[model samples]
Target chain A: MHDMMIPFGPAHPALPEPVHLKLFLEGEEVKDVDFSVGYNHKGIERTLEEMDFSKSIFMTGRICGICSSAHSTCFTQGIEKLLDVEIPQKAKIIRTIVFELERLTSHLLWLGMLGHEIGFDTLFMLCFREREYVLDSLELITGKRIVHDINIIGGVRRDIPPEMIKKVNKNLGILKDKVDYLQTLIKKDPLIKKRTVGIGNIDKDDVEKLCLVGPVARASGVPYDIRRTDKYLIYDDLNFKIVTQKDGDSFARAIVRVQEMFESIRLTRQALTLIKPGLIRNKPAMTFTEKEAISRVEAPRGELIYYIRSNTTNKPARVKIRTPTYANLMCLNKVLVGNNLADVPVSLASLDPCLCCTDRVTVVREGKEEIIKLEDLHGHH
Target chain B: MFHAIVDCVGDGLIVDKIKKYCLKKSPWIFHFCTGGCNGCDIEILAAMSPKYDFERFGCLVKGSPRHADIFLITGPVNKKIKSRLVNLYNQIPEPKVVIAMGSCALSTGIFQKAYNVCGPLDKIIPVDVYIPGCPPKPEAIIDGIVKGIEVLAKKVK
Candidate 1:
């Protein structure tokens, strides 16, 4: 059979985000895959340089809606390190609770999208329906459903009161049961197994070589969670298992995420117990030397790292972000090539590629792709 | 002869009324994200989920622009997507309503000072309804669509 090339959207039904993929097909099999991002680039890194250090935390929170708390927490943690300020214990617990709940919401959203991609709309509905509980809990804590800008430079913005903690715990109790049902449904559903099992298989060596992070790496039998290693926030004080699977396929990734959601529930509940009514924010006096600090947090997708440098002024000298989707994107060819054309969406969705987080800093110039250096990017302004 | 003519005219009027009613009742949506945070896009999806039940209004998010009646746009219009947004706007059939959701769509929101952004969406195409929030809640999105249907009903006439 002659080879044919199919263009899979900068805007396609299978993908809610904008990503263009060129798939070369030999009959029914995908011979090769080429993908291009930057359709969702908003130049956020450069925008960060112009905003105040305090305000930029909120700006970073808006980077990815799914993991807003992750970005802001990482950014704030970096800023705290730069300023040599340690947040209070209460603040630490609050940050951890928000961080983990954000994980639950992000993972649930990913599950729903995975179902939608595989033509299983029922699973999509069920996942989104249960997701409301998490969103409600987030709303109670942070005052917003999607973008919970709860983190500040010194610490968190909102403290979890006793009543709020009780409510959030109630939601987690319900979510735990729903997640259990989802786990069974995912495992027993033959169609889900057929679609996912052995598809998008990534081996342990490839994960290490490519520097994959989050569940994508864990699914390949790598216990490389930054939360466990770095012990950032109150993670070192809490006890939770790093979920992993040996298969390293799409199904393994789903299982890893679903199981991780249970861990998140446990972690949130533990952190809620740890919260004491002392102080939420330290109100650090804004002072800066020519100092740079790096912070890493395990966002729902994976490890999100932020580099923050501060000058004498209130504005940050520079801020750089490395999102998990950017790191996981390295395995796209491994996931897509050789798969059936029909399996492309399901396999790609399994990676949980957040193009919005990945597509920062590249600009198309006069129809030619150009990579802007940090200094040159500043020059543009 | 007069009675027969009256019956024909009455049937034509009734069909027109039904057509207008269906147009107002069930408006198919096409969502396009022009370079902003995924916050608004996800909220749009949440609005369609089981809890919000956006489909009860007979609204469906269509894959192709040709199949769309309401163009729901989110994000700041960046330079790369500016042309494509115009192309998509042109592809949708006439009597369509354009609803720009999110603060970024309204005025470029936080990415206002970014070099890549070319718009608040209105500069590229005329927008009929504006739903503003960093990322508006699902209920607000549904309200905006209901308002857009009103604008669509007027245009259908």
Candidate 2:
């Protein structure tokens, strides 16, 4: 029997996102954890079906604010495949640049949240202060700060002018130094080490079993990045290493993400240099036949896959998204069960669960959990 | 006759004035994200960070609704969180103000046609200020909170 069952959030102080976890504890040690997401679901897949392909691209970008570009990129890549269109080389480089910068911002945001969860306000402050540089560069390129609607169906909607490139490069230069300082601080800080070092340990085998992607898998020594495996979006041309760590703990995850930020900085700079004078969009024909295309991209969190099906019209018949958090969520029990109650927030944040992306279609009927199809959802509505 | 009446009421009135002043200076905030994307929530945090420094206006983001003077709400309210949002609003003590941040909270934004959304926050609760954006910039969020503090001050009186 459990000594206590504490409900953490639909709204909680530790993590502001809407995920509810019922923690069964015995003397401050968490014995079991049952978590439910779907508080943030807006039935996006169903909504996608109602909108045309051109409009749905922006809608997909709003699916998760942190990984907005990743969703749109994946969707666009899938749409391009369905239309049998090839985006220009310049457009591919531009997408890659925006993609990496978005990763930098998302990872920085995650790092700050980790600090806040552990009661280190200074680290949080420092991370956010540094994050503005990345946000500014993104704004310079994409004309928006948070939800960057940079991708269109065939290619990108905007071009990075030469003057903007210089300014963005300058921002990246300053950011590189600040990131170095932060990396040193994380490595040396005893408080952070005490809070995260061995907490929420997931072994490599567990990572494979759970089929986790992104930094979570990399932290467990699994080099299963979609960027390397799929090599979509000019990643084939770019030179970068997949960051991996062997510990498979919270600290290892932090290390993997921090190291990847450096790699992102490098990749973004490389992709920026590769951006030559060329057409940004291929402007494919709007017509479509019966087709289905699955496109994958390594988002800041992990592998984000978009399966889009189109009929004779421009509207996608069915759009399905598989976000990384959905897969990483499987190990929540593994992370929380043996740990102290105080570490719950840190451990959970370490997994970097983006509930906005994860909670799309979940139906509970007669005590059985099922994923209802978009057609069924629409009919019920 | 006027002097005698003034002397009697001045001390209590002075104390009340000081109390109101303090309330206006430091308006503790409680942030809740109903169901929108995390854009606004992160923007709220950014406002609190050193760059925007919302704390300069004596605003602190509190965890519990009971300790809050202004409720900062983001996202379009969804069915799952509707009752919870109302319950949370009721939990805040009297003299509370709600500032709806982001376009979604104002009118459901792009998710207006979404099946699960049941919001535009004001339908569920009274909203004093609306900061409109896909996710309003941190500066705008801070500005909205300052306005919320003003509304809270009026409510206290």
lDDT of 1 at A112: 96
TM-score, each model?
Answer: 0.94, 0.95
Top candidate by DockQ: 2
Runs of candidate 2 with Cα error greater than 4 angstroms are A363-381, B1-15
Off by over 4 Å in 1: A362-381, B1-15
Tens-digit lDDT string for candidate 2 (A101-216)? 99999999999999999999899999999999999999999989999999997789899999999999999999999999999999999999999999999999998888988999
TM-score per model (chain B): 0.90, 0.89
Predicted structure with the largest TM-score when compared to the true one = 2
**lDDT values for all models:** 0.89, 0.90
Q: Model 2 over residues B1-71: C-alpha lDDT tens digits? A: 11233346674767667657767887888999998889898888888888899998888888988887889
lDDT of 1 by residue, B6-72 (tens): 3466646666676577777788999999877889988988999988988988899989998788999
